[model samples]
Target chain A: MARELTHGASADSVGTRPRVAAQPFLRRNVPILALIGLLVVSGVYFSLASDTFLTLGNFLNIVRQSAPALILAVSMTMVMTTRGIDLSVGSLTAMVGGVGAVLMRDGWSVWAAIVVMCAIGVVAGSVNGFFVAYQGIPAFIVTLAGFTAFRGIALILTEGFSIPMRDERFVWLGQGTIRNVPVPVVIALVFGIIGWLVFNKTPFGMRLVAVGSNPEATRRSGVNTAALLLRVYVISGLAAAVAAIVIAARLGAGSSNAGLGLELEVITGVVLGGTSLFGGIGTMTGSLLGVFLIAMIANGLILLRLDPFYVPVVQGRFSWARCGCTPMWRVSATLRRDSF
Target chain B: MVTPEEHEDGGSVPGLDTPEPDDFVLQASDLTKSFGSVAALRGATLELRAGEVLGVVGDNGAGKSTLIKTLSGVVAPDRGTIFFAGELVHFSSPRAARSLGIETVYQDLALCEHLTVARNLYLGRELTRHGLPWLDDRRMARSAEQFLERLGIVAVPGDAVVRNLSGGQRQAVAVAKAVAFSPRVLILDEPTAALGVREVEQVLDLVRRVRADGVGVILITHRMQDLFEVCDRLLIMYEGTDIARLTTKNTTLEEIVYYIDGGSGREHQRAGSITSAS
Candidate 1:
């Protein structure tokens, strides 16, 4: 009976590839190409517009300025891949900076303060994870509320003021570089590599993407979805805290506004790097490229003597265009008519 | 009713038929579950023999899915006993069920569309080399190729992302993943419901292939055509109750439907009158 069914149905043809194979290639590579094109265009424009733009000093400055944002972008990449968002990253960064500053003022060692601040960041992120993953709250809502509440806590703690660290060791970490590379850049690179390995090579990374792509299926496949979600949030929180340390060290102080609006830049970098906002598609390499693209844009605008405020507006517009156009082009270009 | 003795030899032997011993791979007795006031399952009993495809069929809301979830550890039964390999087992989580060799492939196929075929096939249990414990791409691709070839699933590049594959191919990959661990009992819920006629055949062939590998299959499907094609025995559930059990050769679809629609008396009468006339 089974053989009869097979013969009857086998006539329909078994191994024919779908009509369109070129679409996947375009879908995967187009955004990456676009990002590279944008960077090259901007780099050329800036180099022609300003004598300082192409210098090694300016390039190092760009890397230093982009390090915190890059770290946060890396964190966002992991969180968004799991179909969750961390709106509280900026606020969490500020809070960590505030705590570290307070501890430094109290005569704590620079390394000791850094350790305590990072621990606080993990705890804060874990709390966010607990509410979102364990208590079943939407990540957006939980982190959105956290965005305001944590920022308020930071502001209140600092009395709406900035506190400077006069400690030589801490100041050197912020202002000094090792072999012409800023310390923050080094830290971001190390963490970025670690993040990449964790997401790509480890079981934890596999489960993160699996849960993000299809939570129900992952659960059915026997994964603990809540645990994975919780871990992503915690990682995001730790990233934010690390960003705060970088920012504080660079400025030689912890400001209440240290990472204000940074979440937007980090998220922009992630999206610009081809990480989908709807989740389940992205790469650390893309995110790294994205951070550079956003940073270069801001730096280019400054070099052209444009108001820094316009940077955000231009970045916002670029993100909207990318978000609206890229996925549509991908869908129409790659997927077969019947597949949709 | 037919005597067990008449079909014993041709019956595929109750327990020793396969290499496994006489222990039931999975056994559920009087399993009951409810969602709020609605009873999804009530006192459903099932015994899965090694190397057999036991097909379950019923209309909508007949609790077929609930039973599969309970056995696969997706849901904790409100009442009853479950035994696996002759030891009483309570799966507090789905992971527990998997550890005990119970894997399920839901109709949605439970695949990550963004990931490649090899990645999806090895999502939970990926092959890893000694260094760094990273996803051993070469090993995974080789194993995935072998698994697909063993099942006769063709034309799929091992590195192709799942989203790029057709619906049938995705289903095939899901089934392959479930069978990757050599699960003792493979539970496939509506394995071919969404496929075209040809796709359905491919899935049924995969099901038969799994059974031939000495893994008992609990196929929860509503299609009578498929039931007759691959199932060794027929189990009819109605309103969360197991109303009839018969060998596929001895029972008819009409009788199973009658039992499904709560026509036990009419079913008995039809069987009685047919026997008398014969």
Candidate 2:
């Protein structure tokens, strides 16, 4: 190594390179901490308001209820990190789950039904990925069109009727517990860990952020930015497929309405977790926390007997508040450049 | 830590042994490009030798940028032939040119703001660990630290974020990224445009160091004084034509400026027109 160019008495302070991130831990994680606080405060109030809300059984139910969002939000964090959103995923969940339920109703083997459902998810995701990645369309616009078109397709496929399922194996995926944890929750946990390693320790993860930060620059570096963008959407679709399988099993039926408004739900959780909507910044850990936080919020709202419409209104407001406030104090780019 | 080139000799192109006695590091001839009816380049030519810094200066829309883009392979020229390392070459994309040891640092610097210095240095081409498919962050980090220290760049840590670095520091990182690969030709577009005096000097020092290792450097800028400070020769582009070429030792700022202004007295230094330095 070349000898260090000693410039001043302070050896560690060099150029704009910060000393171990001058921003304290408190500032960096303030939003996440705030969400956790919100979760606890809301959890407490609801437990006091209703006798059943505080029970261990209800808490497990909340975990089960959150399983789909938890799984999809992990991949959603990946998509948003690249500054691309996947709005079609909610409709995709309904379509895939509805198809799976239909397959079971027709007497198909559970394994075959699950495999076909996963394939459908991958293909459906590719449709959105194709236009957004290869055609250079904005993700929001492509997925918005997909959001409507996919729902319509699901409606046509199910004929607006719920297809009831009666498979024990399928039901096990949603309701079965592993060592006191719900099966879906367990699966979601595995996905979260894998998502973390992939994002933090792989070249694909680094490339994703690089593309998000500046696609032109990343392309100049010889990376295929378009292809990277495509793979990301595909991953989001695959996650949706798994979520669909679990949701269908839990409800004992598949309907076009299975994941109505779910796109907003998971997207809200992802943004709330500190993944920048503008792209290039994402965290799996933050997404996990945000997903659980939303699940708890939903449980609390139901126990309090608040109007159903307030769920989205309150969720959107909380997410907007945290995202709006956090970057001002946390992100260095926001502090130094103020371009944000 | 400086190399053996002690004096800042601007124009004395060192004679080096090669199979082709008249071989230039890079020679682009009669290049022409057009965006609609506006001809970006009419007929421009450039010649650079190993261990030399050639300054390219011109007004906006004078085709200096077009010339750089052509050589760097950012776009296919409407008409031209580029002879690099003594072989005729055609580049469909910048990556093609880069693989043949040709690299360009554009005006934006091309660094991802969120990436660490090490990752930025090896963004497109990252090394894997123990032959596995995963990126070897620790190896990249350690090597990045070593290279920066060798280049006398210690202000920024290998793990530091690129967005957090100052203008000059970011410029150093960009130059260092190109230099680490040891390319035969390195082209920089206005690296000192937004830098402070000290920062400019830091960049110039790195340029001088790279030239010491026999890499041909092309600097395109509007800063006239900077041309005199480091360029061995000045290639002046005026209205999309290569009308003047002057060895830095044999020319003045006034003469270069006159060429830049498209004066009547300008002449293209074609074959057998080399001026003798007094």
Candidate 3:
């Protein structure tokens, strides 16, 4: 024990060692690069298979159709990065759209309906956040409850009927175009860019990652982890509202069935984009690429006139194949158990 | 009430007496905490001085962790007074304590494995553009590099993900993060546990350097040898109470182990007989 106190031992062994080399660019971006390659291959296949696949009109159509899911994926990426899930998103979309359409059909101004719907989104998201962040409930469980309850509420709002929206101003939100770009596509792009900046360039984004990576560690570092998580759920809820508005205006109806099975689709795209299911890792670029890839598949399949049921089957297969083949998935799995 | 003089050499024992109040850089008296009906800490006390390394040792469930938690503001005490530099302070949160120059490196290391070393080093306290939310990643990386280099930690590249580092390297990074801000009172909880021989030596050497910078360090560990190596004084906790405070040179491993095993009842019988006879 006394010998351990020898003051002569080199304390600066760390100072004199050679610097380790940084990770190579390719190795770090393998997942992103792989997704890009897949996207290109799929593009070539679709273009060769269908005359409409490569047209600018078809490209804008695909972006328009994908706008809602893209917006949802942006928020989902943040949620999943914290090792949480908002299973209620699909149902939330229905509730917001259905309720907002009812308000507008009954003579509520379009802007007023939009404002109220956004507030609803905030309230619903806060409920989920309160339970998960403040009450210490698992996010999956809390949002699962939301999934069931919100859908029921949507059904109640519309009385199980699809109400037609007659407001031209509201209809423009979904169908209008700017310089040939669909309104939905424009909104998606704006949200996507903002999401990217918030996820990559800000202190809040960095802290969000830290919260997902190690909540206790982040808390010890003097961060308000609970507040951060609450904000994430709120964003998810708000995104669902925005998505709801787009879906309703595009369809020109407030149907209780809006965004049906949309949550799984968004999750699939996000996970395929290289975001881990267990939390702590996310890439905004990867998520966008993933959402675009899914949109391509849906559009290409329709152009080929395949059975609509085949779409999900193919998407499911793609997810498994992507997860199975990528070395990154293996890394994510190892990280959760921290076998390293 | 006899006032004890300061021991500049850190080689004198203060048996059955407390050091002068003003001599302590950090002073906590009668700290008590409870989780439900279970009392984790019952009237624990500790004193630390600048440029000194105080080792806290106790058996499992001896409340050493609870005491440290209370001091670090992770858990508020039910009853206690913590005076930092002779000013009574209340810590509502770890952030509050941190603002006053107190930093703690928990036993878990708290490094985000998926993030790069630089990101983890600046995890919560990221450097951002003035009045803007954008991260100054370039500056943070540069500063992280300098921090690691200054600590002689070259094996860990600033850009490397923490998950890929070895256990020793991870510990080194954790220490570097703690010392980066030059905290006044740094509390380390079992920093060298489960580390390799060379790694343990590196950590101890790092502790020596931190103390040389005139910071008061509180080292809590189960490793007895580590205490003798880096700790200036030993504060023994028994059943949630600090029963003995002895200079490192004046106490033997046997005495520390005895006190840790609930030997406070025999303090008078063994005190002068053990080492003060000289």
The DockQ of each candidate is 0.24, 0.33, 0.33
Q: What would the DockQ be for model 3? A: 0.33
In model 3, what lDDT does residue A9 have?
31
Could you tell me how far off, in angstroms, the CA of residue B213 lies in candidate 2 after the best superposition? 1.8
Scoring only the A-chain of each prediction against the true A-chain gives TM-scores of: 0.89, 0.87, 0.91
Model 2's i-RMS, to one decimal, reads 7.2
lDDT (C-alpha) at residue B112 in model 2: 94
> How do the residues A74-138 of candidate 1 rate in per-residue lDDT, one tens digit apiece?
88998898888899999988889988898898899999999998898899899999998999898
Query: What is the iRMS for every candidate structure?
Result: 9.2, 7.2, 9.7
Clashes of each: 1, 1, 2
Which 10 successive residues of model 1 chain B have the least lDDT summed? Answer: B1-10
lDDT of 2 by residue, B1-278 (tens): 12336426555653332325245889899999999999999989888877788899887789998899899888689998999978899987677888888878888898998899889988877877766657887667667766665666435567777877777678777877777776889899998876778778777888887788778899997777788889877888999988787777778766776777775644553111224211
Stretches of candidate 2 off by over 4 Å are: A1-22, A47-56, A307-309, A327-340, B1-8, B14-22, B87-90, B265-278
* Predicted complex 1: CAPRI docking category: acceptable
Instruction: Pick out the ten consecutive residues of candidate 2 chain B with the lowest summed lDDT.
Output: B269-278
Q: Which pairs clash inside model 1?
A: A23-A334
